[model samples]
Target: MIRDSYDVIVVGGGPGGAVSAWFAARGGASVLLLEKDRDIGIPVRCAEAIGQGGLQGILEPDPHFIAHEINSLRFIAPDGTRIDIQQTDEVGYMLNRRIFDQELGRKAASAGAQIITHAYVSGLIKNSDSIRGVKVRFPAAEKEIRAKIVIGADGVESRVGRWAGLRTFYAPKDLESCYQVVLGGITVDKNLISLYFGNEVAPGGYAWVFPKGDDIANVGIGVSAAMIDGINAKKHLDQFIERHFPKASILACVSGGVPSAKPFKKIHGSGIMLVGDAAAHASPLTGGGISNAIAAGRLAGEIAAKCIADGSWNEKDLSVYTRMWDKRWGDNQRRLYRLKETVFKLSDDVFNKAAAVLVSIPTEERSIKKIIATTLKNNPKILLELARTFF
Candidate 1:
């Protein structure tokens, strides 16, 4: 590991940190990105579905990292009714995160960011309440690497954000305890993703079958921490799989927590900035973060670089990140959180009714907007919120 001071230091080698390091280094800042794990994206924690629009500026959709291109989705209701939404314009990707995250790290490295895996960052180096750098432990040695700006992209259980006195706590209602398995020899529509709903399937969350290929898929479940009792996410997932794909082979398994709360009020403080799950940047309703993480990473990195060049790296100097992010996505996130609060609590009967209504619509005219329109006929109280959110 390179032991020295730097202009920017990013904790975590996930997409957020890698993208941040890429931009910061490309901007001519000496950047160091550290990952505690042996690899960048091992033990994948997500459903690995990302919208195509999110990749426009950052990277192209290369086959190397894209497992499957998704153009349609099926929403399976409690009564086994399926509402299929086929989109010609809205394309998504089922990513092989192992390669995708490594590609992000390579981009950071190629842009002149120094990266070292198995480098565990224990805490921050602080002076008079101003962030200075990080204290990291390598496989063989412990060292303190100082930097002008330190970004915390260390994920849901973020000690760096805590160390920096940032708001990183999520109430039980906001956290999703998730479990997933890569199943092989499973038959699925190669071009379509499926979402299964109902209390028996996922309680307060949902179950998904994201096809990686015609015969392979990522099957997962996310259960709301508040709504679940003694039943864990894995047990919920196993039961779902037994009912759905009983003959499938489980090739891999992973479980992790996804924070779906609002972003931290203070994403940046003094010389510190938190991105990715550290800031709770994932979608509250869907728990999707790749797009937002990339967006946040790029913004934070560019801002950090500009601020560093201007010789101003305080909390106020970085407040521009907050404003820009809020302008772009804050209101949408708030609206989604409200929708999730209402939707996830809905009983199986409501989901069944909604699914029946949605299925009745012509498949060619079906979309999320149609779902909202249907909801208006059922629940007039949330019409305003739904309209403001989707339309």
Candidate 2:
């Protein structure tokens, strides 16, 4: 048994974990970061698409890690008619997530945090209602590492938060099954992101074409949990690509699920905290998490530092992270989740009708939200209910 101790232990080495470890170490706490994967980032599971605007509050992602920069977005309706919308603000980027995650981990290590790869945390060591440390299994053996604070930076299947008796299970309706194919030898504009939406295509979510430099693109689709049948996401993705970009050859394929729910009510407990996907920090509107993960991770680490600095570690003291995140981002997620629920319930016929109505609008007024409102305008009762729900 290789027992060790630290002021703070962060489980998972994704962006969230890395950021938490970084900030905790910066705050002068001895931090230990653990990852189940042999490396910081591998077996890419994300579409690697995010808006540059989403990253404003965190450390700027270095240019070497961004695969592509996009200035416009194209929307395709159910009938295959497309609408090209130029963005007034910087809109999108396709990232090299493998490099990105590694850089994040490196930043934490540079800040004096120790990292251990290939370590899977099995369970939390608890003293009645309080957490004390974690039990980990590594390639060589097993060990128990004690810590004053444990941060759950693990992804969606996180057992750390659940083991601590936190609400970590996502509702079926709150998840979107997604698939992505990184294609090379494809000629695309390289500066445009394409989004396709309709019940016939993506169910509750949407399909995206994120260009990654010249001759390459990351194409993907997200379908609601309710839409996943015997038909898997990859099969649907293949069909979509075959019909849309018949000549493109795939270089890599990725599959995962995005949690489209609001953040959990209880992410912080005595001596324990949950960050990133473990706490459902992904935005409900876009099904994006990278930026939010970094933001939440930093906040959690800073809060942990304060708790330790004050020599007080309790659920109430740790509530600073929960309170700060809720005040900044949580309400928006809840509103968007409610909006997603309403839209997902609409049938293809209704969506087609909505599309037709949207195309008729002037180009100057054809906004995504405006189109949705106009489509539902005829449903005065539902429109009123929706307004109340979102507003």
Indicate which candidate wins on TM-score. Answer: 1
On the 0 to 100 scale, the lDDT of residue 225 in model 1 is 94
Model 1 misplaced stretches (Cα beyond 4 Å): 378-391
Worst 10 residues of 2 by lDDT: 379-388
lDDT of each: 0.89, 0.84
lDDT (tens digit, per residue) of candidate 1 on 34-124: 9999999987988899999878898889999998789998989989999899987789998989999999999999999999999999999
The residue pairs that clash in candidate 2, if any, are: none
For candidate 2, write residues 1-391 as lDDT tens digits: 2337888999999999999999999998889999999999887778787788756755586787888677777777777777766665456778888998888888899999999999999999999889999999999888999999999999988889989999888887788888999988788898888888876678778888888877888899888887777666777788889988899889988888888887799899999999988899998767889888888999999998888888988888998878898999888889987877776666666555556666777777766666667756765545655676676
Clashes of each: 0, 0
In lDDT terms, how accurate is model 1? 0.89
Candidate 1, run of 10 with poorest lDDT: 382-391
Most accurate candidate by lDDT = 1
Model 2 accuracy (lDDT, Cα)? 0.84
